[model samples]
Target: MEYDFTLKYQLAADDCDLDQIVERLAEAGCDDATIGVGQPGRVALVFAREGATALQALLSALEDVKQAVPSARLVEAAPDFVGLTDVADVAGVSRQNMRKLMLSHAAEFPIPVHEGNPSVWHLSDVLTWLNTRGGYDIKPDVLEIARSAKQVNLAKEARELEPRINQQLEYLLA
Candidate 1:
């Protein structure tokens, strides 16, 4: 079976250039790896395998890279999924608060579904909602109000600002 593996490494402050790391990995026989810049100073490498031996080779290459860059961290490697959930895990808020947020902010929250009801949200949908909603800071009402106000103000400001902005641009160009 084919499998995808993701390896993450955090670079030190001085080691910001990733070309060297990529070169090292390539030299170590990891030619088919895709490298990307992640949040802040982290780098991510994605590798694919066709069998257990290929996976082992990838792991060994990763280990070699890790030894060369001791600051790099091996975060995780798993199958990709659309969503995930842990019902009892509520670290960002108290259990009661989480329940309150769920109850009061139904519009902002992803709709939960009953097993028998197809109209209900899919597990993936609920998980997507939870992940997004969990990180959201504004209240539902506040968000609505802010959004409406922003629309109104933007329309008004655009009408007023466009002429002046255009004049400035014309002046700069001239």
Candidate 2:
């Protein structure tokens, strides 16, 4: 018997800030994962499998991603198996980097769906690995610069509206 499964996800604000979702999927026993942008704040994942126990593996994978990235909204779909290269694209990392990370710590990487052939990394595994490593912090000056920029933009917007407000007042008087 063959078991095929798919899972999609919509990420929340906090979830967007990290790659934990991908890492978690890998831990759950899924193989061949792909992620894509849905709406502005949504992320979709498609996982595939082929085995008698594929369905059970898929469910385990989904639970893992959900637990790790609580803000993620999941949507299951029909499996459309993708390659490791595809998973790399979704993780925003190069294939080389993915391999390097996995090779560095084999225990941390996801299990391959097939015994032999083009090896594929599960989406959940990638997310779980990412969750283990937190994001980089911004420099203090960079944050200050961002704050200044925001203030400038707000001031410019207010200035632009002032003329319109005056014009409306004049029209009302007339």
Candidate 3:
């Protein structure tokens, strides 16, 4: 299977030389990715990799990036975090239509990850909801890749949490 996904990173101050980073990435098994270094301290790699599963492909890319840029911090793994507009684009529907669906099915709609000005959600959650309703033409691989990206982002964030706080939150949230 070929999984399509993106991995974005925040480069360490010492690791911000774009040319060196690009050369290193190419040598580190990331020749399959389209590298983006527009931002001064950031890099985004859009990859189409082959593996048995979405997770395997994504994880391998993650590992390759880490090896190539040891000082860089993983900022996000995407197609995971998005707004209604993003979802609408992916679903081939107008933004207004997608908003209407969310409003009409507010109770059943998947919860947003952040609820403010422009709210955001996990793409897989919205896709799963649409899939259940039987009208969207979502690709299975897209859903799998989105899910895998979400997992990767969560795991990276999890590593930053204090174990004690995690335990307390786990118990309280549960």
Candidate 4:
């Protein structure tokens, strides 16, 4: 099954020209990918691919970007949902500590987008919260993995709904 993923990279240098990077990526086969400059001088790269694991997608994306923009460095790739374990890892804390921090700041912490055994929150939101609180340094590789996972999940969901959406359209046209 195909997966959708968004990988974020931090622009390594302040003077790095984004326009040049975008042109390079476009020429290197990531034409459909998105390159955005976000909070804390980050360049977020988002792409969707099918037929490989999330990690594979991440690697492929990185390879593509490297080919286009050798200096651009990915900084974050957190998926839409991440368990406490992953969150804690990103936050550089024990899972238990992460839980305690969440509990202590219940009102402020971004609520998980999805609730389950290990509730997950959007990578951007979580990192923003943590960065604001001066708790952790959001890492790029971690975000890349999260982005890949989230993309894959999104792709799967989209694929599942394709048939129904087509049927509805056909019915309306008929």
Candidate 5:
């Protein structure tokens, strides 16, 4: 099975140059990796690899990124998925409100791409809706910044919650 993983790194808020990191990673044979504008002061690295090769590829990419930006520290790593709270945070609303909005505007809200205990949506789809919702009138540049912030917050929250969620799942399964 092909397992995909996203790794979040703590980047220095002042001197983090993502473009340089990308160039370095590319030179290191991790050309497929991407640096996403995460949170107000962080960046995220995403990798997709298959089987036994996955670990080595991930480690290689991590090493490359760290070399490029010495301040980089692995924050969290996980399989791809975005949670409801992430959507809510991106939308600048409470989770309860987001839930209500999704329910009432079911036709307009993007469907969850990953259906699990928390039901997650694709970041792109949710960002699209957040940027272009009928009455909100959010500008593109503003939305871009907002999207980055949301991504950062979402990644952090997901990392924080992963263990707790796994424990709950284990309890339920048992």
Candidate 6:
């Protein structure tokens, strides 16, 4: 299976030589990716990689980038964070319809990761909710990739959390 995803990284000052970094990435098994460096000190790679599973594809891409640019810090893994329009596009529904569904099922709807302006959600959460609701045309591959991307992003963010915070939230949230 081929999983498509994007990985954005913040490059250390020393690793800003775009040409050299591209060469290194190509050499490091990322020849399959399309590299973008429009922003200073940032690099984004869109990949279509073959793997046994979406998780395998994402992890392998992360490892390849790590080898290519050790100083690069992951900023985000994409197809994970999104807005209603994004969710609607993937679910084959109109943005208004998605909003309606959310408003109607406010209590049962999955909570957004960020609540304000145009709220954002983990794509997988919305997809799963729609899946259970039925009548939504959710592609298996898309749902799988979105789920894998969510897991990867959460794990990356988890590395920064204090262990004590988990202990603190465990009881409160549960």
**Better by lDDT, candidate 6 or 4:** 6
Candidate 4, lDDT over the whole model: 0.68
Give the per-residue lDDT digits (tens) of candidate 6, residues 58-102. Answer: 999999999999999999988999999999999999999999999
> Which digits, one per residue and each the tens of the lDDT, describe model 4 over residues 1-174?
344567666667653776776787789878657667655556776676543465786667768877877766555454666777777776788989878888999999888877776576876567668878884777655555555555655554556677889689669879
Each candidate: RMSD to true structure? 18.1, 21.7, 0.9, 14.5, 11.3, 1.2
Q: What lDDT would candidate 6 get against the real structure?
A: 0.94
What's the distance in Å from true for residue 2, model 3?
A: 1.1
lDDT of 5 by residue, 3-46 (tens): 34567877677656667766766676555666687575677766
| Weakest lDDT window of 10 consecutive positions for candidate 5 | 141-150
Better of 2 and 4 by TM-score: 4
**Mind giving the per-residue lDDT tens digits that candidate 3 earns over 91-146?**
88999999999999999999999999799999999999999998888899999999
Residue 25 lDDT, candidate 3, scale 0-100:
98
Return the lDDT, model 5, position 20.
Answer: 73
Q: What is the lDDT of residue 147 in candidate 5?
A: 44
Supply the TM-score for candidate 1: 0.40
Model 1 residue runs over 4 Å out of place are 50-58, 80-174
Instruction: For candidate 2, write residues 4-95 as lDDT tens digits.
Output: 34455667776664355556655554335665555666666554444334444455555666666666765333322335675566557787
| TM-score of model number 3 | 0.97
Report every candidate's CA lDDT.
Answer: 0.51, 0.52, 0.94, 0.68, 0.62, 0.94
Q: TM-score winner between 5 and 6, please give it.
A: 6
What's the count of clashing pairs in each model shown? 0, 15, 0, 15, 1, 0
Clashes of 6: 0
Candidate with the larger lDDT of 2 and 5: 5
Off by over 4 Å in 3: none
